[model samples]
Target: MNTKSLTLRWNKRHWVLLTSLLLVLCLVMPQWASAHAYVVKASPEENELLVTAPQRLTLEFNESLQTAFYNIKITDPDGNQADDGNVQIDPQRPHILETGLRSGLGDGTYTVSWKAVSADGHPISGAYVFHIGEPSGSPAGLKDLASGSGAAGGPLKWIVSFTDWIQYLGLSVMLGILAFLLLRIAPASLQREPMDVPGSYKLLWISYGAASFAALVSLPLNTLYESGVDLNQFSWALIGSALKLTSFGQIWMLQMLIALLIAVTLLSGYDLDRTIRVRIWSSYGTLLLVLGWLLTHAMTGHPAAAEQRVLAVTMNFVHLVAAAFWIGALTAMAVCLPLLTNRLPAKVRGEIYWVTLRRFMAWGMGAVAVLVATGIYGSLVILPAPVLTSLFTTAYGLVLIGKIALLVVMLVFAGYHTKRAKAATGERLSRSLKAELAAGAIILALAAILTHLSPGQPASAGPYQGTETTEDGSVITLQVSPNVTGENQFEVSIKRADGSVVKDLEQVTLSLTHLDMDMGIYEITIPKNETGIYKADDYISMPGNWSIKVHALTRSLDALDAEFSIKAAKP
Candidate 1:
C-alpha cells in the first residue's frame, strides 16, 4: 500500500479502537451518578401572610443535611432580628431544619434567610419573604452563598477547588504510605517485620506533614467557600464564626484533630528494631489514626447524608481504603525502590526487587476488586436509575467518566509491570510503576472535582407558567421551573401583538400574589438579558395558586398579567 493509504488505514483503526473502549466504559459505568441537596418545601411558605405570628420557622430538603452547618435568620421589616438565632435539626425528621421565632411578630414583612451544606458536601442556600397581617415596604433579599453552586464565581471558585484537590492528593499519599507499610511490607517479610527500606519511613513521615498542612490550610478556604467571603476580606474572626455556626467547620475541626494526632505520633519516633513490641504498637496506632482521618471525610461528604447512612458511610470508607492500598503501593515502590536498590549488593537487590513486586501485585489485585465493588455500590446509593442512564450528560458524570478512563489506563500499566516484574530487574520495572502513578494522579484530580460538582440538575416538578396581553398590544410570557414549593427561577419573554419579538425595554418588574390564601405581594426586579428576556430567581416556600403581574416601562407604561399555580407533591 502507498504511504497515504497506510496512514488512512491506521487512523481508521485508531478511531475504531477508541469507539469500542468508550462503549465498553459506558456499559460498565452504569452507577457512577450523584446529586446535590435542595429545598423541597418550607413552612410559612415564601410570601405567606399570617393572621397570627409563627412560633417557629421550618425548612425541609430533599435529602438529609448536616445540622452542624445549617443557618436560619429572620429579620423583620424594621431590620431587627426576629429569630432566636439558634438553628437545629428536628429530632423526628433529619431532613427538617427548624429555628424558634421570638415570642411576637408584629405586622410588616419578614425575610427568612438560610444556608446548609448538602449531603454531598456542597453548600446551598436561599431567602424568602413573608408578611404578618399586612404587607409593608419591600424587604431586602438575602443572598444564597452555597459553595460550588450558584454561590461561588470566577477565581474564588478555582481557589476552593484547588485547595480541596491538594487536600485529597495529600490524603491519598499519606494513607497510601501507611497502608503499604502495615499491610504489604510489614506482614510479607520475615516475622511480619517493618520493612527497613532506607528513606521509606522518612518518606512516610513527610507525607503526613504535607497532608496535615494541607488539611489546616483547607479549613479556612472551606470557610471562605461556605460563607461566600471575599479572599481579601478573610479574617480569623470569620474562621471562628464558621467553626461555631456551620457543619463544615465542625467536620474540619475533627480533621484538624486527627491531623495533629498523626503529626504528634510521627514526631515521637519508633525504634528501628523490628522485634520490639513498641514498633508494632506504633504501627497499629498510626493505622487507627488514619482510619479516624478517613471518617472526617466520610461524615462530611455525600455518604454521611445517605438515607441508609451506615451502609453508605461504610462502603465509602472501604472504597478509600482500597484506593489507598493501590495508589500508596505504587507511590511507595516508585519513591523508595530506586534508593533501596542503589544501596544493596547486586544479588540481594535483585531478590528483594522481585519479592516486593510480587507481594504488592497480589495485594493490589485484591484492592482493585474492593474498589470496583464499593464504587458501584456508592454510586447506586447516590444516583437513581434515570441519572445512571445520563452518566455522560452532566459535568459530574463526565469527571467520573474521566476517572474511569484513567483507571483503565493505570490498570493496563499495572498488568504490564506485573508480567515483567519476575524477569525485569531495574529500569524497565521502575518506568512501568512510574507510569501507573502518573495515571493515578490524573484520576485523583478527576475524583476531587467529582466530589465538588453537583451530580445533575436538581429534579423538578417542571416550570410554573403564565402569559398575558398588555393594554398596548404587547404580549408577556412568564415561566418558573421545578415550581413545586422551594426555590424557583422566573423567566419572562416579551413580544408585540404584531408577532415580532420585543427587543428593548427600560425596566421590567414582576409581582406575584395569592390572594385566595392571603399571601401578600412579593415583587422582584428582573434584569433584561441581551436576548431581550427578563429573568430572576427566588424561593416560593409555599404550595398554592399564584398570580403574576408584569410591568414593562419604556417611553410608556405597558402592563401584562397572568396566573400560575404550585402544588405540594412527591418528587
Candidate 2:
C-alpha cells in the first residue's frame, strides 16, 4: 500500500475544469428569463417610441425584488444620467418597481438599464431602449449606458461562481470528514490502545480554514453582486443596507454565525477520538450546527421563493446532508487512507479498513436512498406542470443529465471498491478511489452551477381580453397581458363596426377603479401611435373585481365613455 499512489493533487488539468466552469457561467446566461428576477413588463415597452418623455420609468418583474440593491436608471442619448436617482418599491408590492425621471428633457433614444436581486438572492440585470418623439441613437450609445450603469456580469460573475464552488466544497469536506472520523475511525482506534494523534485531524483543520474563509467572503461578494456595485464603489454602506433591509441579508448573517460556531467547536478541544462521551457530544453537536448552517443556505435559494417553502427547504437540507454523508465521506476516507497506510501495520490496518468500509456501506446505502428520493423531488420542484416537458430541453436539464452520468460512474466505482474491500491496498483499489472522487468533483461543480440557474417555471398565461360595442356602431377592445396583481400592459384597439380603424378620437383615456373598495381612480391617457393601437403600462396593485372605463373625446368635442368590468388575479 504505497501512500503516493493514493494521493491526488491540483495540477493543470484541474485548473482547466475551473476555466470551463467559468465559461459555462458566461455563455449560458443570456437566455435566462426564468432565472431569479427578469423584466416582465417595462413602461414604454422595449423598442417603443414615446410621443412625449415619460414622467417616471417603471419595471415589473414576475416575482418580488429586493429593494436594498435595486438599480434602475435611464440614460439620455448622450449617456447622461437622466433618472432622478430614486428607486422606489412598496413593501407590500415589490414586483412593481418605479423610479422617477428628470423633468422635461429632449430625448432621442433613452436606455433604461436596471440591476436587482430576486427574493431568492440571485442577481439579474438588463437594458432596453425606448425613444421620445422618434428613434435616434446608435447601439454603441446604449452599450455605453449599460456599461456606465455598472451591471454585475463579467469577472464578478466568475468570481461569484468560484466562491460558490469553494463554499460547497469546504462545508461538505469539513462536515463529512469529521463525521467519518468519529463514526468510523474513532471506534476502531478505541478498540485498540490509544493511537497516535494522526494527520486526519490536520486534514479536518484545513477544511475548516477553507469553510470559514468562504463564509466571510461570501457576504460582501453577495452584496456587491446584488447591488450592481463595482470594486470602486464597494463600501460598508452597501453591506449595511443588505444586512438591514432584506431577508437574504439575515440569512447571510445566520450562515456566517454558524461558520464561526463550527470553527470554535473544532478549536475548543473537541477531538473526535478523545473518548466515547466526547465523541458522542462532538458528533451530535457538529451535526446540529451543520444542519443549522445548511438550513440557512436552503433559506436563500429557490425554496424561499417556492409556494411550499417549508417543505422545499426541508428537502433541500435533507439532500445536502445525504450528499455530505455519502460522497463527502468517501472523499474524506480516500484522503485518509494514505495516511493510515503509513501509521498502522498491514493486519491491524486492513481489519479496521474493511470494518469501516462495511459499516459505512450500510449507512451510505441509506444515504444514497435518501439522495435518490430527494433528487427526484428537487427536479419536480424545479420543473412543474406546463414546463415539466423541459426536463430534457433546458440548461438546467443539461446540467441534470451531466450529473446523472457522473453519478452512475461513481456508483460503478463504489461497487468495484466493495468487491475489492478485502484486498483494497492494491493500486487498482487506489485507482478506483481516485475515479470515484474525480466523479464527485465534476458532479459538485455542476451542482454549484445548477443552483444559480433557473428552476423551470410554467409558461406565463396570455392577456385578458374584452370588447365593447359603442352606440354609434363603433367597437373598442382592450387586452391586458398576464393580468396579475403587479404591473400590467393595457392595450386598447378601436374600429368601426364595419372593421375600419377609427380616426375620429382626439384623445383616449383608460380609467380604472377597484370595484370592491374606494381606492381611488387611476386614469392614464394611453398614447396612440401610427399603428392605430393605444398602450399603457400600469399597476393593477391588487386582486379582485375592477372597473375599466374607456373615455374617448371626439374632435368635435363630443365624448364617449364606455365601461367594462374585469377580475384581476393575484401575483
Candidate 3:
C-alpha cells in the first residue's frame, strides 16, 4: 500500500482496538467493582413469604452507610406504613441497618422501599415485597406506596462532588504555599540578604485567601451534602445536625481550624528578620497545625473508614505530606521563582537561583520517593488482594491506574526540568512546572472521585427473587436473573404444597408487568423439567419496578406472584 493508505489503515486498526478494549471494560468492570454500597442481605428477605409479621426490619450491606441519611418505609397491603419510619445503624454492626416495624400485620403482602447514603457518599435504593400468612391472589402493586430510599438526587450529588474538587484544589494550593514559604523562600532569605520577591508574596496571599474561602464554604457545603438537605429549606437546624452528627462535619470543623492557623502562620512570616523567621520556623505550633491538617484530611477519607485504619491513615498522611512538598516546590518554581530571577542583580541571580534550585532538588527527590512509597502502600490498603487484576477490573483501580499514569508523566517533566535547571530560567522552566501542576491537580480530582467509589466486588449476576405457595397445593418460586435491564433470565420452580417436586404439569406460563410505569403484560411460556424446575430467558426493554406472575395448570390451577425492582447498568 502507498504511505497515505497505509497510515489510514493503521489509524482504522487503532480505533478498532481502542473500541474493543472499551467494550471489554464495560462488560468486565461491573463484575469487579461497582461504586455504590450494595445490599448483602435484608431482614424478612426479598420476596420472603413469612407466616407471621416480624417486629423489625434489618438490612446488611457490603459497605457502610451514612446513618444519618438513610431511611426505610414499609407499607402493608392496606397501604398503611408498617415501619415507625426511623432508620438506624446497629451500634455493634456498622453495616447492619435496622428499623422498628409497627405491630398488627394482617394476612396480605407488604412492600418495603429504602434509600441510604453509602459511606462513600452516594445514595442507593430499591424495593422488595414479603407477604404475611398467605400470598395475595392479586398483585398488591404497592410500588407507589413504597417510600423510596432517600438517595441524594442527581443535582445534589453533582454539587457535592464539584464542591469536593474545588475544596481539595484550594487546600493543595494553600499547602503548596506553606511549603514554598517555609522550605524555599524563608531559607533562601536566611542564606543571604532578604530579596524583594513581590510575586511570591502575592501568590502566598492568594493561596491563603482562596483556602480560607474554600474552608468556610466547605463547612456548609458538606453539611448539605451529608444531610442531603435542600437549598430552599436549609436552616440552622440542618447545620447543627451536620456538625453534631456526621463525620464530614467534624472534619470540616478541623479544616476551619487549620485555615485559621494558616492565616496566623502567614502573618507570622511577614517579619523578614532572620531571628523572627527562624523562631517562627522553629515554632512547634506551626508544624503541629500543618501535620494535624494532613492527619484530619486522612481521617476524613476512605482510610479512616477502612479495615486497616491505622495503616491506611498513616500511609495517607505520609503520602499527602510528601505530595504537598513536591507540588509546593513546583508551584513555587512556577509562581515565585520568577520573582527572584527577574528582580535580583544579574550576578546574585545566578548564584541564588542555582543554590535555591539545588536545595529544592535534594528535598524534591526525597519527597518524590516518599510520595511513591506511600502511594503504593495506600493503594494496597484500598484495593483487595490480587491488586494487578483489580487494577483492570475495578473502577477505583482504573482511576488509580489513570492517576499513576499521569504521575508518570509528571515525573518525566520533573526529571526533564531538573536536568535543564542550570540552563533554563524564568518563564521556560515555569511553563514546564505549570504543566506538572495541571497534571497534579487532575490526579487530585481523580483521587476525589475514587474516594466516592466503593473498592469492592461487583454486583452479583444472580436474580432478584421471591418464593410463594398457592393455598391449594402448589409451591412456586420466581427469580429475575442479572437483575438488570436487557436480556434477563426468569427461573421458576414448582413443588407440591407438601414440599415434593411437582410433576405432570400440563402447562406453565409467566407474565410480567411494570408496577409504576404502564407497561402492559408481557407473557412467556416457561419450559418445565421433570425435576419441577421451569425456566425462560427474555429481555426486559427497560428498568423500573416490575411484577412477574406465574400460572401453572395441572389437575388444578395454581398461581404465584412477585415484584422486582430492576436497575439499569451504568453506561
Two-way lDDT contest, 2 vs 3, winner: 2
Give the per-residue lDDT of model 3 (tens digit) for 90-208.
88888878899887778887777777666645555656667788866323454332222323344555555565666566556655655655554434553343323446556666755
**TM of each candidate vs. truth:** 0.65, 0.67, 0.70
**Tens-place lDDT digits, model 1, residues 27-130:** 55434224556555667876777898999998777777654446888999988999998789877787888899998679998887777766555666666777
Residue 60 error, candidate 1, Å: 2.3
- Residue-pair clashes per prediction, in order, are 3, 0, 2
Q: Each prediction's Cα lDDT score?
A: 0.65, 0.66, 0.63
Order the candidates by TM-score, highest first — what do you get? 3, 2, 1
Model 2: runs farther than 4 Å from truth?
1-34, 49-53, 76-81, 105-108, 137-140, 143-152, 184-197, 246-248, 269-279, 337-345, 348-351, 383-393, 422-428, 455-571
Compose the digit string of candidate 2's lDDT tens values, residues 255-305: 878877776666543454477566556555665787687667667667676
Compared with the true structure, model 2 gives a TM-score of 0.67
Where model 3 places Cα greater than 4 Å from the true spot, the runs are 1-38, 61-67, 92-95, 116-126, 134-153, 184-196, 271-279, 282-288, 347-355, 422-427, 457-571
Candidate 1 residues lying further than 4 Å off, grouped into runs, are: 1-36, 46-57, 63-95, 98-112, 118-122, 129-164, 178-193, 227-257, 260-277, 344-352, 422-427, 456-571
What is candidate 1's TM-score against the reference?
0.65
